[model samples]
Target: MMKALLATVLAVTPVATVTRLSLPPPTGPAKVGVVTAHLVDRSRPDPWVATERFRELMVSVWYPARSVRGHQRADWVTPGVAARINTPDSGFTLPVTHGHLNAPAAAGKHPVILWSPGFGMERTSGTALAEDLASHGYVVVTVDHTHDAQFVEFPDGRIATNAIPPVATPAEEEQLIGKALDVRVTDTRFVLDRLRTMPLARHMDLSRVGMFGHSMGGAAAAGTMLADRRIRAGLNLDGSFAGPVLEAGLDRPFLLLGSESHDGEQDETWTRMWDNLRGKRYRMELDGSAHLSFSDFQVLLPQLGLPPDQVEPAVGTIDGPRSVAIQRAYVRAFFDRHLRHRDGRLLDRPSPRYPEIRFP
Candidate 1:
């Protein structure tokens, strides 16, 4: 029943990437928790324009907390967005919050999920999905890929503006893809390792883990599954396949949830990845959905007074309620099935209840 209450109001896009200024106020008996760490891309160099000290990131881990009532919730973003409009290279500062006010803190080990946002998108782009997962008792670790994301905010007043990587040229796209695979997989693997040692995160259930992403983030999800055997399964939300993932020929349980543009015969990457799945594999397409459909922006656009055409027409096909509900159901089902080893009809087959979801 817990969902992103203010999801409709949080808008993030290619044009305007303002971040959360404060954590969502708590609610219910369930509490919330969050932590962030900087990750070096290793593959890219900071552009000349980037501040030398602002090259690193701060990635947050959100979960249901136990006793967040007394603790102060972090801001959703830094306070400078309004005043720093002239700073073209600034990042969004986010607050680390416990669950809604009066919400109960989660106890014991729960499932764990590693999250990746789309290309050129910060980890917060998938906040709606991430927060919902956290509310459902998953330790959601959202990775902030340095030099790739716009910016990542830290607990302190400091912010890390995205260090521009080597300019991505047409000729370098393939190399960038390869580098992305390395960056995503290594960063996730390190976090999993570090989580075991984190004094604060000692309660996590490391064995129960899954990976997911949107757009290029989706591709990174598949890449993580291939690179790490510790991951039980993976899910991709409308990301194309390339890089070493296809070359390796994936052999684990994976899901490809795509948009309308990516479901056709011309988009062979989706089909090729589908063909290469050696374990359980499923594909679903949302009618009229676009590349950005998987992100929360779909719901935030109308609330921001944006025109209908501002979002891809295909993305508009997915109404907010149905879209968010479907995302919650399927994502929870995927992680629930593999991480918890539970049986769920949501992942069993195409259902009449979710008429909007077309399984191919």
Candidate 2:
């Protein structure tokens, strides 16, 4: 779920002075371009906010750019989303990103990777990973599940927020999460269908599509793969299986990348899901990382001057840059081997470069 406000407060021991925050530059050779589209799913009603007539979504597409020389950089979070996430008294300013906004897509049909952020989190929470993949010649599509996300700003200036209320019991929590997962799965499939007919379709190799998500988003990735045959591979970052995939099993390539606190051994859900995998599968854990380390929060939270203790429980004990580097490397490797038909030796064994990572 979007970083829990209560959890953030409980995790942080001492709040530090606010300072300038910035995301690291994309590590690939090519420049990145981003474009946002506002879509409405007429077939479905708003799942969380029942008052809405239809399900509206905001999706950001990041891709390799023809040139970044004259393009404008995008904001890490749009003004509307930032407003909803930050209080008037909060001293934090959202970071500026490195993506060239609305720049022309680079020539070539590149493989696609669809990304979904955690529950209540903005789509931009996955921007770092998306931009990295885009820079490496992948067309990355990140979706903001309207009414499920903390805030989704549409082109017409409407802002949608998570309307699902807090749950009081475990059963209630599970029911809410299950409903959210169903909506996420549908949102993903709808986005893919729309992408296939958009102008960007010319530059996307849809047949080679893959998906990865953080926290609840990761769980949605698994469910999406089960529901949509278009997704050839799926990766879950610190998310547990909460859907039918746990019993039905998956027949395509799947990877489980988790933090020290939860892996195949530590979490029964992971073990159960791992056992159900019927196709090519791999599981690995980052020794010092936490649930949010696989997300942009690994860097963003630290830059916001949140004390290490406050961030560590959620993002883990790993240094922000190191965590991001390991994620970028491994995620790229997984997709490369599965989608691009490349040999990603890094996934085959333990590597000296990231000794903190362990295979199970």
Candidate 2, residues 1-360, lDDT tens digits: the string is 354742463243333444556888889988999988888899878887777889888899999999988889999888776665555445565678879998888898999999998877778888888999999999999999887776678887788766878889999998988889998999999999999887789999988999999988899999999999999999999988887889988999999999997865567889898989999998999999987787788897776666566677777788988888888999999999999999988898999999988996
Cα-based lDDT at residue 36, candidate 2: 86
Candidate 2: stretches off by over 4 Å: 1-18, 86-89
Per-prediction tally of clashes: 32, 2
| Tens-digit per-residue lDDT, 86-201, candidate 1 | 23433343344343433344778877898888766677667677777787778888887755665555556555554435645877866766776676677777667767765446
lDDT of 2 at 257: 93
In candidate 1, clashing pairs total 32
Indicate the residue-level lDDT of 11 in model 1. 34
Worst 10 residues of 1 by lDDT: 1-10
